[model samples]
Target: MNEKEFKKAIDHYRSLIDKEMANEKVIDGKFVGPKKLTKKDKIDLEDIIHPDRPFLSKDAPEDLDSLYVTTFRVGNLKKPEVLTKAGYGTDVIGGIEFGSNLVKTGLIESVDDIAPFLAKYKIGILDLFREEEVEDGKKLDIRVYECIDCAGMPNIGEPVCYFETGMLIGILSELTGKEVFAEELRCWTSGYSCCQFDVDIKETKKGLDG
Candidate 1:
């Protein structure tokens, strides 16, 4: 997409974030937290066709530049409630984790074996709607990643995919012409599990504006 078009898309998503935030209901007087995959939890992700790899955590370099957004969802395969309540389909075949495994393993493995594993895992998207009550000027850290769909590639690192983040603040900033704090953006990689964006969101903003 062109620069203008991409900005418009970002703006639209930002509006969604705002609307969701404003309409959010308090359950028992507590704001909700975004759904997320912890570093340890993400390590066990398995695919049908690819061999699993040990978890890798890389400290994001400070000098890198990129624009990122924070968003949230639960990402375990075992919980059906996590998927259904979040409005994601539990029956949908070939989700991000499935694709990641396919890309990592060079084989087009049977979908049946993978189905059971996926059923035990769930990616919670509802957590994104949960907000923590923070004093004005308080800061939070947000994680971001890119989602890639490897088309018949066996190598874990070779596939091209889409990127996503759980940072609602950044999305709102882009939509509302405001600035989001840099420290709020965190980066992660879910190899063969989902498409993750690794670049800095701050750098991306500079490029878009330029």
Candidate 2:
């Protein structure tokens, strides 16, 4: 990730922690709701968050859409892991392009709203956060339990949910009309109970301006 993306992510994390603090919890050594503030700076929140944080080291990937695969085989893709973002861009943005065409043809609503609609065709639940769950100007977090790609695949020992991450960014950017970034923070294959992704959404005002 670049500097701008890094800053946006860090700022969102701080706000997430802030929300937790509001509920009266000692998180990262700070209290906000009813407890006293122990230190001026706890863990120096800014110092801990940065960009270019690589989590995947998979040697290869396979694109599932390339074939008329079965229901059990979705979200699969093949690509060199070195490119980092290539597989995701190809899959996610390509899906958006296809969805856009459908919308233009009056076959669907919009690219942004297509996720939940398409979830029926997918293997796992693509749970997106409701508007009330997120405050304005903050990043969006999504979860996918029993993800099609990672759940049944042989354990790869790391997060390989990049395609879903990219899909989320594409969906939101199509809806919000702003450049957004998505990162997979956890994956079922990575030993997490579910697949979790973080997205740096476009600020509502900027999206409105667009």
Candidate 3:
């Protein structure tokens, strides 16, 4: 990934908060309690939280370059290896786009689905840090694969990736300084899938330097 491009995207998203506030748009704060909601509010929240949307970009990968990096957090190395072995040649349910080789894996339908999954599985955040000897840091690359179930299927207008739901939680944990637990993992028809979970950092490990 291009570091500059990634940073630009982060900055652009950060700017949206101020822009929305200036325009008097109602900004939904992070969901922190069980507040009663109206039917319209529930629907609006679902649309924003679980948008079955796919991003169409001419710059997206082509047929010959369909590989993408899939990231995940397996607290233990053994689990990662086990998952890799289990996922081999497995077909994942998702949508495929016409004339393009991009496959979208449906991982979750909405944030509301996270709690149930978390109730079933144990999730943890993983941090991999290292001391750099040089002023410029080195880049680490990981290979992403399409789920075996959908790898050879014809394009049906959905997005696919090899990423796992837990990895996404790890990313959020690192970003928000909280412990994220999974509730559900669902593959979406929307070119991509997302995981929903509640975060709690009450008694997590801290101050480890790699």
Candidate 4:
């Protein structure tokens, strides 16, 4: 997309996010938080695909600038719920494809390699506490220290690394050859020293019988 088009897209997204945040409230004196977007309010699938490409283009002068964690934290200050969903939406639309390519290209060859690869790329320092076979598939307890998304961020009362959670989902799904889902169980923004994810691997039909 061209500069004007990219700016329009970003503005449109912000409008939607603002609308969603508008419904936020306090219940029993506790913050209700940003409301979820309904079907009509969601960002279109096509728009979510590679939404970062515009920002990543070398030809884009804005690309010369780097966004700090504080910038994101400030954005999340009032719209954590919507922002989290936006991150997940990006993953479902294209982040998975992007992450799977890491394995497809031999960058990540095994489950044991995930941590080192993450560290190599400065994504985070990954720690695998344990993995166990569940009834249908597997469960992994994973932690990330110095998480790019929320490390050193002040307590935000909720987990705020939906993007990273989705990244792990994609990476693990490709690495294990199964459908994987990950949930952010803890985060620095939620008063944790590290980010923790509970990953669930689902057995496919082929794997079920194999």
Identify the leading candidate in terms of TM-score: 4
Q: lDDT values of the candidates? A: 0.27, 0.46, 0.26, 0.58
- Per-residue C-alpha lDDT of model 1 across residues 1-210, encoded as one tens digit per residue: 233533443454345445534543333443322223223312222332222111110122431211111111223335554343343232222233444444346332442223222222211111121224344322333221122112111322221222222223233334333333332121122122222222222322423543
lDDT for residue 143 in candidate 3, whole number 0-100: 14
Alpha-carbon TM-score of each model against the true structure: 0.22, 0.48, 0.25, 0.58
Better of 1 and 3 by lDDT: 1
Model 3: per-residue Cα lDDT at residue 82: 46
User: Model 3, stretches more than 4 Å misplaced?
Assistant: 21-58, 61-167, 170-198, 204-210
Cα-lDDT of candidate 1: 0.27
Candidate 2 residues 52-155, lDDT tens each?
A: 11111111144332222222232242344455444555666665565445455554456444544544444344455433334545566665544555543322
Best of the two (1, 3) by TM-score: 3
Give candidate 2 misplaced runs (Cα > 4 Å).
1-112, 130-136, 204-210
Off by over 4 Å in 4: 1-88, 91-94, 205-210
Clashing pairs in 2: 61-77, 61-78, 61-79, 62-77, 62-78, 63-77, 63-78, 64-76
